[model samples]
Structures are given as structure tokens and as C-alpha cells.
Target: MCHHTQPVTGVPLNSCTSREKTSILQLLTLGMNSHTLPTCRVHHMEGRADPGRVPAAGGRPEEGDEADAEGDGPWPEAGDPRGEVGDFLSLDLGGTNFRVMLVKVGEGDAGQWSVKTKHQMYSIPEDAMTGTAEMLFDYISECISDFLDKHQMKHKKLPLGFTFSFPVRHEDIDKGILLNWTKGFKASGAEGNNIVGLLRDAIKRRGDFEMDVVAMVNDTVATMISCYYEDRQCEVGMIVGTGCNACYMEEMQNVELVEGDEGRMCVNTEWGAFGDSGELDEFLLEYDRMVDESSVNPGQQLYEKLIGGKYMGELVRLVLLKLVDENLLFHGEASEQLRTRGAFETRFVSQVESDSGDRKQIHNILSTLGLRPSVTDCDIVRRACESVSTRAAHMCSAGLAGVINRMRESRSEDVMRITVGVDGSVYKLHPSFKERFHTSVRRLTPNCEITFIESEEGSGRGAALVSAVACKKACMLGQ
Candidate 1:
């Protein structure tokens, strides 16, 4: 029984119902796996660093090489060929809105470089979002052409980096096969296809410009690499916004999908799909199942459905509905607006949690939702928000703890130090999410000394940086 037990992972298990306690415990189990969590597929960075000393196929690096240096970091060091000095174009297509960015990298003294960038955001139409692959890519190409025309650089063959923020299996830095779509995307003829190839075909059809598609990366990988520019110690990158996922540098030996066991490679842990194999079924609550069934990708991205911003608000609304039915909130009544799908946005969760106990903010928000919330009703809503958000924070922390602990053990260190680059509205904008998340991560990863750095323009900057690194490596390898 969880009764009378001390709290773990910052969640007061003693105060939780039996089902809630089980859910938290299952998350801990998922995070504490000793081996690489099979729930996430391994997508390497194609071994971006140490390009010259490429390892033989399916073989380990020669002993005494830096690849064999156990305690050394995985990122490239200073004074190396970072990238060619020039402007690179990067496309970031993660959500309904995609960004087209022009990044200028200029060399400075002592191998350091200065980067300047300008970007434009274009919204994807509802038809395009749910259309065929060709339609979607063609729309994206049109956006790219417009951006290039605005910059008056359509003729210059610039290196391009594509940041497709979805789950993918990479055959190389430049080739990623779309495993499946998440975040409400349902473009046909995309799954199991090479996303880069589709974009290339679309660009070729456009015929208005030429580009050298250099590299493609997930948003998490981009965040990690982008933050690596400011902090070389940042080897892990995590995103906790509309969706939750993470990436980290892993020892080559553990990445069974890749060939060589030489240097470390970045692995995109599409951890949002963590519970799809029914590992989480035993702990899932009624509200969770409701959200999952209603989502576009039902029975998918199950872990993300619990913690991502896209679902947090829905979860809270369901809880509120439950409370109302139990006569514990709103006098056992629900407004018509509250009954509507998506009337309660995720932002409401943040706003409700931010209320300072005066209940003014809570009353205003509920009133807008057509609810006449009393003082007691406002208090109950606030408590419900805290419970949902806290669970989300704790669950996210457990996943990150698993990654950090795995890194520490792989390096054979008792106390491993690392820095993580994180980005997302939920993590950055929430009133108490960062603190709650940090506390649980520390409790779960006792052997790690961790530093968290919030990323700025992670997807845009990261896509460009990935291209830069790939370009530099290619030049060295004479490829």
C-alpha cells in the first residue's frame, strides 16, 4: 500500500488515490530501465563528430583514440571545422505553422563564429495538413520559394537543413523515413517515406531555385545541437510543449540499429510513444483513455497524451467534469461551453495554476467558459489544475531521469555531470512546471550532476547548426 509512504519523484504518493499511485510508479519503472528503452526507436546523427577516423563497418574504434575516451563529451571541440563560412537556409516544419529561416555564419577570431538569422512563418491550411504528401510538400516548397524571393537569393545554391519535428528513422543525417505523424498531422503517402526526398522532389518541381539539402534533424536533436553552441556541455535536448520528447548522445555500443561501436551518436528518443505497447494500460485512468480515444492518433503517442501541452488542458477538463458529476465542483453542473470539445485550452491550465488564491483569475476564466463558478468551485478547479500539471511534470522528469542515468552508467561513472538544453512553452511559460520538474529529475537521477539551459529559437537555429556540422564533416571526409 502507498499509504504512509514517503513521496518519490516529488509526487506525494501517500495522498494519491490507488490508481494515481500506480500510474506514477509505472512511469518510474519506464524511466529506470537499465538498457536502452525499446519503446523508442534509435535514430543516430550518422556519427557527426570525429569524421576523419571513421570506424569500420560493425566494428569498434581503435583503442587509445578519443572515441575510446570514456569520460570525454560527445560534442565537437573548439578550433575544429565547424562549417563553411556562408549563409545557409533552414526549413523548420513541426506544426501547422512552419518557419523558413536564412542563417548567416561568419568566422571570427580563434575558430569562433557569429551567426545572424532572419525567418518567416507561414501557416498550413487545414486541407494541406490533412492532404496528400505531394500537396503538403508542394505547399512547403511554395513557402520556401516565397521566402527566397523576398531575400532576393533564389539563384544562389545554398546548403539547406530541414527540421522535421516528428518521429523518424534515419539512414543518414540527410535521410529520415517518416515513421508516423503526430500532433494532428495526417498527410497521406508520408508514413514510411523519406521526408527529405519528398521535399527535394517538391523543390525540383518548383524549378525557381536550387539548394543542397544537407541534413535533417528532429526538433529535440536540433535543440541539443543549437544549445551546444552556447554550452558545449549540453549533450541532451528535450522538448515539453505541444508534445513531449527528448534526445541525447549515447554510446555507440548501445545503439544496435547503427553499425559501428566507436564514438557516441545522438539518439532521438521518440519517447512520446512510450506506452503504446500497453506497458501503461494498467495505470491509465478514465480521463487518459478518453483523451486518447478522441485524439487523431488514437492508441499512439500515449505517453505524450499525458504530459504534452496539447492534452494537458483536455485532461484537466475531464477531471473537472468528473468532479462536477461527483458534486464536488460547480454544484454538479457543467456549462454548455464547458461541454464543448476544446473549450478549455491548455493555456487555461497555466492560468488557473498561476492564480494567487484570490480566485479572481479563476472566476474570470470559468465565466468565459460560461460557468458561474463560486468561491469553492474556483478553489476546486485550482486544485485540479495543480494535480494534473504536477503529474505531468513528474512524469516528464522520470523520462529525463532515465536518459541521464543511462548516460551516467554508460560512461562507467559514479557521478556524471551533464547539461541539458530544453525548450517548450509548457516548460518555459508555466508558473511552477520548471521547479516541479527539476525537483523530480534530481530525485530520480541521484548519480547525475545536471544543468538545464533553456534554448532560444531551438528549431530554427538547431536545423542550421546541424547542416553546418554536417558540411564541415563532409569537407573533411572529401565526400
Candidate 2:
């Protein structure tokens, strides 16, 4: 029972009711398999073309071929060739951060390949998120021009890769229709518009220099590509931070959205939005429901609400709020700041968990929130933090396990090793997150050997690699 005891107080995890604990376990178990995922189906492209449009014979996606699925969308496989010499540029206009990167890919010791990159991050203003698409793109373009000037690459006509980490309906490698926006971005008139075209137009408006938009990809896909560049066994890519999503190599035949040769393509499993049908609804506690109800997009990203970093602190806050009402926390006098939504952040939880069992950090956190916590109160807070963080770790493992299990259905036992390329602050900085996640995966899939590789700047590096892929394919088609 010590394993279940609080690290500071050595008391069993009795803070929550037995029923609540059972529900949390069920949530973790349900995600350990994919059959329960609401969005697990042949991905639909909404108004996109038929999957059978690609001829069964050999040909790239021409003007009429269904473009969103696979044919010529820079579909990189395990051993795709990446040239060793190029100074490529990449722009990432996804999530809250807009970035521009320049890469010099060349040879290293003993003819081995090496890559060096420089990138700058720009924060988007609040107005841009709620304003028109043109406003957002214009700001992004200005940043790119500034980055180029800093690197003295003002005269280069470099082939560029665009990483737009949003739901897009691909028309080709360099073009795609923005299907929808997520992660608190609501760029008006951006939805249903082509992001690549928007970027191209934005760049042209600048009228500075020539830059070709060679490919467009999400961060998850780029992470996988980056990993595959370093290791041949990486097939899955994931981003687990403020929000969570995954992409993996899947058979073209199994994907209802694409049709063509007998090959595999990366499928962006937007697992963050997996609980649309309320599959995991029953397991949600009052605190979880409160966070959902108060969210910017309620009743969406259900899986993320339970597992993502942004919500972890809020969940802990809500539970503590409940305990306060019941005279069990903060000595029955909760601070007004603690009552406010979004006041607590994930860093606080991490700090509490990493404290040396002396409760100093938790004491400081509560003091900041206008609460004075007794020794017992600190222990209670620690327990709550551990419960929420542990559940999040288990959920992440379960999601990864589900992906592995689905892949195994069609793979041979000879395929013994699988590598996943993942990035995000939560995985890198959170105390004990990776250990718990690895443990959970091993416990659930005892027979499979899975490795997690950290691919930093996956979006930037991947965009460079994918641009190379697109350029090579274009050359092949011209032959």
C-alpha cells in the first residue's frame, strides 16, 4: 500500500471516494485499446473526392487525382532519400507560436549526414487570433522576412516547407484546404481557406524575395519525419504538451480517405477529439465536467480535456475547490484567487510533485493563491496532484498502446521494434511523467518492444526533410 501512499505523508490515497478511483481506472483502461475511440474509422475528408479516384496502376496525383489522400502529398516512407546538401527554409504557423527556421544539411565525419538549423519563435498577439485571416498571415509573413534578414539570406530563392499544425484537406504536397482550427486559434475567414495559398499570397505581398512553398505538413507528421531521418524504425510521431495528438504510418487501403498503390501513409489520428460520442463521458468526474463546461470549445477535445497539460492544473484546482467546500482543504477557507478559473497552472502541479516531501513548494503555491495550508492540507494537495498526473501518464501510454495494437494487427512478428518520436514540455519537464508512461506501456503491452525518442524542433527539421522529399518527387515526375 506504500506505493499508493502519499510520498510526503505516507498515507494511503483515500482522498477520493472508492467509486471515483474506479472511474479513473476505467478511463485509463478504455484508452488502452482503440475500439473505444469514437473517431476511429476511415478518415473522412468532408467534401473531398472519392477514395477510389486514384487509379490502381502507377501514376502520381495528377490534376484530377484525389489529392488529399496520398498520391503526391510528400508521403515519406521509412527509407525516403534526403539529399545531404541544401540550405532550406521552414516556417511553422501552428499552435500559439509562429516560427521561422533555416537549415544547412550537409556531410559530417566519415561521410555521415549532418544537419544544423537556426530558428526564432514569435508570439502571436491576442488580437490576431480573434481577427481576420489576413491579419494573422500578415504578421506571420513579417516575422519570416525579419528572420531572413537576420540570417543574411535575403537574396536566396530557397525551397521552403510550411508546417501548419491544423486540420487540413490536402489538395497536393504544397497546397491544402484548412479544414478547421484548434488549440485556441480562431482566425476569422481562415477556416475553409487554403493555408499554403494564404502563406504564398502573404509572402508575395511582402514583395521581398523569391521563396517556393514546396510542402505543407503538421508538427506531428514532421516529428515522425525528423525521427525517421535519424532512425529507420520510427513510424509514429506524437506531440504531448498543452494539447495532445498523434500521427502514424497506416496502410493506404485501410485509410478510407486515400486510394492508390499498395503502400503506407501517415494518418493524422486527431485522437484529441476522440470522445465526441461520449464514449468516455461516464468516467468524467464533476471537476472534469466543470473544466469542459467552462472551456472555450466545450464538448470537444474530450480526450484532451482529461489528459492534456493545460487542463491538469485546472483539474487539480477544481478538486481542491470541492474539498474546500467540504471543509477538508485549505483549512476550510479557500482563497478567492483559487476560486477563479485558470488561475492555477501546470507548473505548480509539477513543482508540488517534485518537492522534496517537505511541502515547501506546495506551501508557497497555496500562499500565492491566498490560502494557508496546514501540514495535512499540503499532503492532501500532493495526493491530488499525483492522482491527476498519474492518470494523465496512464492515458498517454494507453493512447500509444492503442496505436501500436492497431499497427500490429497487420504486421508480422518479425517487425519486432517500433520507435515513436515525441516532443513537448510536459513530457520533457514534468516530474516522473516519462517513467510512469513507460511503465504503463510495458505493463499493458508486455510482448511489444516500443521505444520513445525525443525529436526536438521536429516541425522545423521535418519541414526541411519533407521539402527535400517533395523536390525529389517533382524531379522524378519530370523524367
Please report, in order, the local distance difference test score of every candidate based on alpha carbons.
0.75, 0.70
Model 2: worst 10 consecutive residues (lDDT sum): 57-66
Give the Cα error of residue 74 in candidate 2, in Å. Answer: 11
**Local accuracy of candidate 2 as per-residue lDDT tens digits, 23-67:** 433432423332222223212111011223322211112211112
In candidate 1, what are the lDDT values of residues 1-479, reduced to their tens digit?
22222211233224545664454444333223322221221112122111222222111221111122233455545213255678899998877688999998887777677778999999999788899999999999999999999999998999998988887767767887887899888999999999989999999998989999988888887788788778878888899988988877778776555467776766666778777777567557888999999988999988888789989888888888876676555657899988887889999999998887667788789999998766556656776787778878877776788777777767799999899999888999999999988987887778889999999888778888767766876777796
Decoy 1 TM-score against native: 0.82
Q: Can you give the TM-score per candidate against the true fold?
A: 0.82, 0.82
lDDT of 2: 0.70
- lDDT for 62 in candidate 1 is 14
What is the overall TM-score of model 2 with all chains considered together?
0.82
- CA displacement after TM-score superposition, residue 478 of candidate 1 (Å): 4.7
